[model samples]
Target: MLTIHVVSHTHWDREWYLTFQQFRFRLVELIDQLLALLDADPDYRYFMLDGQAIVLEDYLEVRPERKEDVRRYAQEGRLLIGPWYILPDEFLVSPEATVRNLLIGERVCRRFGPKMRIGYLPDPFGHIGQMPQILRGFDIDAACLWRGVGEAPTELRWRAPDGSEVLLLHLRDSYSNAAWLPADENGFVQGLAELRDSLAPYATTSHVLAMQGTDHTRPRADLPRLLAAADARLEDTRVVHSTLPRYLAAVRDELGERESRLPVISGELRSSQRAHLLPGVLSTRMWIKQRNHACETLLERWAEPFSAIAAHLQPEILNLKPLVDRAWRYLLENHPHDSICGCSVDQVHREMVTRFDWCEQIGEEVTRRSLQAIVQQINATTPAIVVFNPSSSPRTDLVSVEIEPPPEPDQPLLDEAGRIVPYRTLGRRRREFFGMEVDRDGFAFLVAQFGSTGGRVQEQLTFRHAEIAVEEGTAHVHIVVSQREGARPGPFDEALEQAQALLTDESIQHYSVRVVEDEGVTIQFVARDVPPIGYTTYTLRVGATLAVAHAVAHAVAQKPVGATLAVAHDRATLAVAHKPVGATL
Candidate 1:
């Protein structure tokens, strides 16, 4: 007999085109009614809350009194709450962010009741390659997700990098399987038939996971009666109101008998997948992407380890966990499919930026506390900064510290034992201090191969920023002065001929002096004088060398608009314009 588990749910986006408050009004109503139905009617077997915990948070924010009502239902195995704090875009965040998201989900939902056992990521853009390992780390062994599956069957063994595997189900059409579910008995009969027929090919087992809701959907209070009516019209099928775990568990059994019939998909979920899940979103809104990386680095690389070490040293600060969790909540809020994917409306993204700012602020403050605690106990003799390797295991790496007594630009910096440290400038802040060489307290970046203790030195690294000055789209030539020049062709004419031949290539760094018709405006090509982040602007001025100026080739053709010609300081000035559309020049 065919068994169909009609999983009742609502795909809730806390904020999308509408603001959170606007969406909350609908969410509050939905949850209020859903809660009432689950309690008022004993027949309403179960209801799934969008495979997320944010809906719970949003619900509690407005209807704080109904906390137990929701929890009671969850504890009874009649409601599914998590697998995610918020349904995040799988591609836009770091693996650590995913781990933290699941951690928050598991932590919060456990307070209410038993959380959803499966990694029920129904709405992420695409699954990452390492998702199996991540889920397994959280002790979750299976996942049900939609998007990024091409012609493949819904059931597959998705493997991770570490060879760990997950039982994955990629929903074919959508999580909204029955969005246009029929209201009348006759319509419901036809709908069930069409749904059954439609799902036959994708079904390898006697069970099918049926989604009975759409985006921002309500609990469809009379779905149980409708399923009962639809079942009477069917001959051999058993239609029942059920949850995902119940359905997937049954399907898992069916698949076990017919193992070879299903496909095992390896690696990530991005490919010639059905809908493509709109892959462009990965690179969209790069400003947000860059900021996200920055904040994530601060939290994952610095703040977290620093806090862990601090907690190891001081047991008193353990109470800061709730505050840290709040910070993480804010950061995770920014991980929603639309929010962190950076494809939301301007208002939504603006709110996201503020959330990020909040996370960064808390992260910075926490990190500062940790550092202050570490640095305050230093017993160094000379000008040295106490540094800690945040890694748990023994590590010896290049350590950089900004010292108060700024060293001279060329002076070698040393440790407390008077050891001369070889270093390069990473950055310097021009603040004057009382004992500084330049009469200012500017901080100097002193990098060195410092051993953590008596261990081996490994992984020498430095952060360097270069300021290259080039006009947009313009190609540049660099000549190293120290490189021995080709023996200068002993004869003058041979040298001149050789120079002429070399000058033909635009990349050739041969000396070129164009006097602009010798109007006293000399243009020299200098490879040695470029500053960081500086640009060389080629302002064309009208001069006697009209033919020479006209022949100048640009990286991108810049046409002379109306030939605006003038002379400044005995120099030819030519005003060039950006390449105009449909213009050959």
Candidate 2:
């Protein structure tokens, strides 16, 4: 007998053409209806939450009152939630990010219910090579996916580079194949026949899967009745509501002895023949990719290691793990297939910038604090430069250090040993501090430079005035500014007029001052033997030298009075003679 497992699921792209908040409003309505159906109808069986745990958080954020409803449905084996935080694009993010995605997803899902064990990747552009091994490490033995595979049977073994394999289930056409199953008796009969005939040829066993929903779609309210009609009308076929896990279990039982004979496919699945890979997303909105890599590097390479070192050296230091995790969460929010792939609408990508900013800000501050904590225990009275190497290999590289009070242009630096360090001055620059007093003209220029209007800087007087500081205990109001690329000089005219108008209106009646930049010298010196995952400190010494004496060599060679030249070739002479028979030379 043939068994048709109808899996009801909605492939939720959290943010695509619509911004997250906009799509979130729709999600609220979908879940509200889903909870009602699952509560009222026992035969609805199961509804997959797009194989992600993040959707639950998104849902609960708006429907806090429905927490128990979600918990009840999930715990009762009727709602399949997560083995992934979000279905991320396999190639865009770091391998570590992928691991964290699963690791965090598993933890969050298990809190209220049983987590799905299958690697349920319904829609990623392609699958990665090591995915099987990664899933196996997490105790997952099966994977279901929709794209990036060529012509093959529905069931096969996907192997990782390390030889670990998983039972791979291919969604041949799409996850939306059975999205509109017929409701009436005649329509059901026709639909089941077509589905059975279409899928049976590819099935390794007598079971075939029919996914019953599409993107952001609610479950069919009368799905149970529809399945019952098909079951009764069909001959020698059992059509029932089922989930992916149960279907896979039945397939395993059927293929018990024939499992080894299943075809094995390995490595990354990025073929474009079966489905479009959307490869351009890798290069589109490239700034987003750049910022993402920077944020990941800051947290993983710098903040994390320093925090670990500080925690071990100074137990009394403030705990930074919470802050670090928060930053990581912010970063991961942008890792979804649609979000990080840069395939979403303008507003969706725009919101990603703010999240990246928050993540980077938190990571930078945490790294600075951790290093400061470690520096406090260094037991040095004079100023010193601390160079840290966060990689596994020892480093020998030049490091730039900004010196206060402007050092001599040719000043030599010294290490812990009394040896002179080879150094050169890159140049000097004025580092302006925030909240510094500036004249009306300078204030206007700064405003025009940093502020942007409509996400562009081409128009004058268009940028919004973000902030203006009125200083206390000083006769000056502070205007903070930083240099930005593509900012023009003439746009400051309107900003100047606005600042003057504010001053005349008594907003800064008592304040009148001019800004002056501070001078600092930047010097580069070679840092040697910086240990892996460790730090080295260097000191600047004035007029310091080693006591060892050096001897000078005086030697020269004179050309000989007579020169001789010699050339050697073969002693025997050769003649250009041709010895050919029929062929022309």
Candidate 3:
């Protein structure tokens, strides 16, 4: 009979320099107490290690003898594997940072003993899509995690958008919280008993009783008693202290299965949903938007100041390069899933707003000096101002541009042609001018008039396609409304007719569609109102210019018009729209 292997881990969220002496004292005391307890037990041993304790280099150097023992214990496979250093927040970090942390952790482990195969991330706030590939790159075979499951599945597997497979063994819900904050020995025993009984129904020869470290503020006196109780319980179940590598090896041998080709990490797999399986869906889109906005804001504010400082003291602030690099890396990691921060949607939004403010501050300082050098170098030429509107679609051609004016009230300003452009009076002493209209792509060119008072000059510019040439000396803009290529008469009216056709179709009684020009098409399907076990289909024709703004479906096609857009029934969300040339869609 295969014995039940029990694995225990301690996840110490490192706050080294911030907490300073207090943190060191807490860690040292915990280690001392844990080591004493483990040394006293001959039958049972504690697998203890700090979580991302890379910053403990100074303390470790002072205690050479103890460090040697730790190294020796690791060589004998007593110490479980973790990352080289502490990762700030798994969800908040970039894929590269994650991989770097893993590599560093593995390197540290190799310094003492053998390579670690299983990655451990007991609690990542949530999972990121790019993590699987990162794990695979590090040669990690499996990982453990707890927070992702709201509901349990029968079996576990590594999943991603690309269909890569990894072996997954989710932590049982009751056992997960119980392991950390066990109520009593009886309660702990009961939870373990339930887990054993649940596994009885499945074909399992061996099992792992994984638990957390008995340190921290959480009282866990039940662990020692529960370990003793399990010793006397089942015939086939033998409670042995195990690490991830040992446990994975035993499970693989017991199951007689070959090693999986996929990389495994600790998090919820996104591949289970068909919507994520689609091609060209990058996980970093949301992060990219936040980063781009933050970068632009920084460049605008501090570029000049930063540039002047660098020029004045050439190599004086070179040491600050590491700080800048670290800051950028942190931003890259946390940029993704900014929407999923905190416990709820509103809380997440609040957190994002706060972080965005921090990013803005950092950007302003960095850009101030950088831009000063640029201005000095480009002083000989007329500075061209470029504005960009970042959105999925085009905006109204008209936009506002505000610039600083000259100090003198009567200062003469000349256009490229040396002509004084006419201005509209905005206030008692201020004046305003209108520029060309900007098109959907948000690109426009305008000449500014020189004026005194030197405060700020504001103007509204309109954008349009270049092909629709404006009359000489006049700003004549043409608007192009997107419509289908072969649609007769009104495309919006044709879409409404198709929507009405679906309403009359007998096969699609469960579904309904309403066409709203701005919001695209609205689809509603009430499954409970229809037959329980049957499926239905509805079809509608939409103008080629029309796109799917949002959709939701169960087993059937909720909106048959989705078919015309080449959308599959299994997709949870789809955004289909046409894009202008040289624009991001």
Candidate 4:
């Protein structure tokens, strides 16, 4: 006789704002109801809880009582441990986070019963590149997932990118609606019969009938009846209700000593072709970009003050390690798939942007106060000024700085002359750096050297600006660095030559310089900042030498627009237009 396993899952969102008392009450109520139902049949003996819910529910206190009942069921070889918890939106969570959560769940399950070997991720919107390896690393022999498997073959086989073998059972999209109320029971039964008929040709091989749904919110009245009806119809065929672990074991037993490699197939839901289903992927990327930009802005503006303060004061004050950790956790909790599949862009924007804004505000406030304290302390040792740029984009123009003295006069601060000294200019440097010929708009560090007894004290200072001069009619380049005086120019020159060669070969169209003189040539060198989170501004200078013109042409063609041109020939100034001459031109 084929063994039939009944698996029921309890799912709850981890981020709901519920008090401890409310969480306890809900856990107790759900367990009580589920236990009462399970007591009715010896065959009906398994319950799975979402891992996130178990952690958020805080069931530690009542776990002992629940454990006794679970042990009783396990003693009868009935209760099976599932994934430590059902992680919501597996795609959005980092691979490390997913693996850690699985390990945590395994630990939790081991405390209750034997460790679970099967992996279950019912809600990953789509499979990522490295999931199969992660699952196999955790000793999870099989995985049951529903999303991303649109219209693909649903047989068990190895599907990981790294060529690791694992049993994969895809849940049919048709059965997904059956988990909710108001679904047609007759239609569901017919669907099962239809599936059985379709699989008749493959009767020589064993098949798994997988179904996934939430037990927490599902209508209890209709489930038992639906199961009974479906079971009766599927009895004639070799249908068995089995969990992922049991199914995998069966496959292993049948295919012993045989190769299990199979091609990876896209299992995404086809109906999700609409834009709403993928807004989370887009929104999450946008959130990261926006938050990074905002934080970069604040840091650039106050980098001098903050760095000086941090250098002198205790490391405990400027400790951002905890904040970064919290941010990572927040990212895991509010992942896009956790909200809803096929959600509107506007809705995702509202939710993610709001969270990013809040995070930015907190991060900015923390940084601002810490910088203030640092500035206060560093000003005593030497004159110091801090600048804060809170814009999402980089700033190019010179930022003014105000130096101040410490509040305590009795602290006995001395100047270079062995006398009391007031505020003074430390030094100034650009706040940001970019690889290309562009000025990055961000925070800068400036320190003014004080005059000492040895003629004039040369204080060590670091500057962000660098210059590259291409000699007339020669490809050899000269690099002058304002910072890192000891930096070797030979290697940089070689690297620049290599870069130019590659650009010439690949982007040759942008290599020719065109002189356009229309009514008086106006060659404007417009400094364009990088897009969105622009860190640098590039000033394209076009000069009249053949080499310079060639370089300018390449740079201008590569530049967005508004590059400056210098006409060397006596006749009129050189005017260069970005637009190529078409038939109309």
Candidate 5:
């Protein structure tokens, strides 16, 4: 005998095939009818709020008066709210993003009541390799996913790359396991029979589980009455109207039996029986993806920790968490599967651009404030450049800055001890736009480090990008800066062409761009690996050693990380941001 757990649910896509307003019109009707069913029907003891708490947030924005009613049902454990703030496409974002997605969801859900413990994911293109490890962080031990199941069984033990495991259920028939079940005695009985037949073969235990709704499905107006009627008529097994958590609990207890044998599946779920998780999303909307990567790297790797450290240093002046959280929430809201994957309607993506802008703004401001607090204690009078290396390994990289009345074209950039920093960078920027009253052509960029933790650790030697003030705004600053402007190599694609031609004739056994701090441009003959992750800093000095000149030019004219090297025959090499399609470097 099989017990059919008639689990009721709605798979809500906040903004998808239709815009948010269009979806909300139906949501208003659905929730209004749904609460009526739950409130009036004694036997209607269960309803899952689409496995996301954000639905409630959306609904409340329009209908604030129904708060108590929702609180009652959620608190009573009848309406299962979030195990997720929103269902996110696992691979579209970084590991930290996935964690924050779950964290935000849990935070909101717990605000009203206890959240559903199950990691209920009705729809996602694919699951990441590290989900189990992340889910364990939330103490979620069980999950239900559809895509990426492939030949794996409906029930299995799934493990993440980090060896963390979660008991998983793959919805073989998809999330709409029992959608459109007729709200009548005879029809519902037939529906249950067909549902049981479909589920029986795949059922790992005597408990047969089924989801009763699909995307944006309306609440079953007479669900409770029909469920009662079906219960009375069906005799072979108890047909119970239930919530997902209740059904899962029953199934867990049933799994305690000796005959139950769940299979074990491991690693990322990128493929399934019918659906192939779209691999193209990794590169889709590439401009947005690039910005997302930069913002994530800056905020997580630099801004957050640096601010925390700075707060301790100057607690009164640098309390910047409120600004940070606001930005984070905006970013998380856009991480939904359809939104971040860049596969949604034009309207949805348009909204994402605004959110990304907010993220960048907040990141810029927070980074500026945090770094300024630290720089303040360093020096105020002498113009100094602070080169911050975010990577752990040390190598040389170029850093740029803009100052009013910029340096002479050939005059070398200097460090604190007054050394000529050998730089092979050309192309001047005298923009119509200037920051802090600094005029165009006032920008001077130079090489900052030799073999320092490649920009991950703050190496305060030199810098530039965006508008930031180290001291007071618009105040005149004095420092001997290197002004660079000698370029006839054409655009990047063309320059790479010329550099590539120069490289064909060059062959060196071994070469390196060593960091030499001479009072003037000093070049050395040393070589080493760039940091594990980030831009490699390489320096080129005038009157450099013959070995250094040949090595620098040859390396720049390569097909990997963008190289800025001073090579032979007075030829300048320039490669701007060369990342081959999916190259990790």
Candidate 6:
């Protein structure tokens, strides 16, 4: 006879075909009903919260009074929440993001009660190769997933690239096998038999799992009673209500002596043998992918390491942990399976842009503040450029910086010991602008006026020989406008006439052209052997033999990791055809 462990749960996709709020409205309803059902029914032993902790936050945001009720169920082992913040697509986001998801998920879940320890990835489309190694860090020994593998048993040992292994429970008939059962005993028994028969071949042990859930599905309040009635009608199976952990424990006990004999699967699971892998999601909505990578790189590479360095050097002056944490939370919200996989509705991806912006803003601000704090500790007196290498290995690459008051074309860049360094001037530009103060209404009026006047205030002003210097204004600084070198026929005369009237009017004050003659030249030079995750100092010398020249060569440039030199084996002369005079390799 087959022994079936019927696990009741709901797979929640926060956003997909519907926007987040639209889906979240239904989420609130589902949770509210589930809470009431758990309160009334002692027979309802377990209900999984889709293997995510964020749903709790989503629910509590609307029903703040039911916080303790949630904590009660979670602590009582009745409602399973998390092993992940969100069930993300394993391939789209970075590995660091996945780790952060786990870390934040566990942390958030522990705030209410104990988190589900199993690595529950029921609907991730596929799985990663290094997932076993990642789960090992959290001491998660079991993973239940549905996709990304060839023909395999319901239970197997999944080994990572690092040789780390986890007990894998394959949902042979998908997570929704027993999702919406019939009300009658005969229908329930027939469905249970079919589910058992399908999963029996894959089951190495007598205990087979029947996940009773699907995407955004509500928990079946009558599942426990139906199982009880079906147990009496079923001829060859004994069905019982169970949780994921309980199901895994039973399977483990069933395979106690012969656990090692279970089938072993390794690496990434992207097979489409049984389920649709949907590989095209990787390339779709590429802008979302690009922005995600950009934000991740900013936080992981620049903001995080530099902030740590600053805090270590000046703990009293800087504590950026909170800001960095906030940034990560914002970024992680975009890593969900449908959202990051680029398969969600247009509104869903559109909302992701704002989160990305917030993440980037926080990261950039923290980086600026951290760098300023670190620079305060430096003892250098003369004006010098600080080149920071955020990489682990020593690097000898060309670095570029813009110097104000334009360094002379003949002046050579110098190292710390006053040694001449080879350098080239890329370009030089003179920048100037103005500033002013205005109120909110005045700001809006100016914006409207600018729009009405053809959105080319700069072009209009440039043609009038009086170039505007500010584009927009803040509440504290009103009427700040700027313009660049462009000429077109517009309401230039009208704008100039209004400006003349305003100059004579008594209300407009602090109207000044704060010209900043930033005639800076952008210079590039090879910074040799910059220390790993450290900084190097460089300066410009007034008088030195210019070792660098901007000569255009007609030779092909080969891409190499570092400086490469080719030697002739037998006194062979290097020849260059159609090369510029004074050009050398």
Best by TM-score: 6
In order, candidate lDDTs are: 0.65, 0.77, 0.41, 0.44, 0.65, 0.78
lDDT of 6 by residue, 1-585 (tens): 788898888899988999989999999999999998998999988899988999999989999999999999999999999989988998988999899999999998998888898999978879999999999999899898988876888999999999999999988778899876777878887888888888888788888888888888887887878899878888778889998999888889889978787888989998889888889999899999899999999998889999999999999878999999999999988988899989988999999999999999999999999888877788876667888888888888878788876554345566887664556667756554545455444544654665466534443233222334333331122222224232223334555454444444445443443223225778777788988888888876553432322221111244233323343434232222212222122
lDDT of prediction 1: 0.65
> In candidate 3, where is summed lDDT lowest over 10 consecutive residues?
512-521
Model 5, range 1-585, lDDT digits (tens) per residue? Answer: 678888788888888787777888889888988898888876777888877888888888899999988888889888889878888877777888778778888888876888998888878888877888888999998888788887655678888877888888778778887897776678878898888888778777777776888988876767777777767877677778877677777778878753235676788887756566777877788776777777788778777766776788898777998887777777777877777778778888888888888988998888888877877767534445455555666655445443333432333334444333344333343422112222211221111221132221133322121121223222222221222333111122332233223223333211111111112322221123334332222222233344333443455466336433322334243222213221110
Q: Cα deviation in Å at residue 197, candidate 1?
A: 0.7
Give the TM-score of each candidate. 0.70, 0.78, 0.46, 0.47, 0.71, 0.79
lDDT of 2 at 473: 28
- Collision pairs in model 2: none
Better of 5 and 6 by TM-score: 6
Candidate 5: residue 80 lDDT (0-100): 87
lDDT of 2 by residue, 164-279 (tens): 99999988867888887677778877887788888899999999999898988888888888898889989999998999999999999999989889999999998877788898
Ten-residue stretch with the least lDDT total in model 6: 546-555
Q: Report the C-alpha displacement of residue 212, candidate 6, in angstroms.
A: 0.7
Q: Which stretches of candidate 1 lie over 4 Å from their true place?
A: 257-261, 317-320, 387-402, 405-412, 422-585
How many steric overlaps are in each model, in order?
17, 0, 34, 31, 17, 10
* Model 6: CA > 4 A from native: 408-410, 431-518, 541-585
Give the least accurate 10-residue stretch of model 2, judged by summed lDDT.
548-557
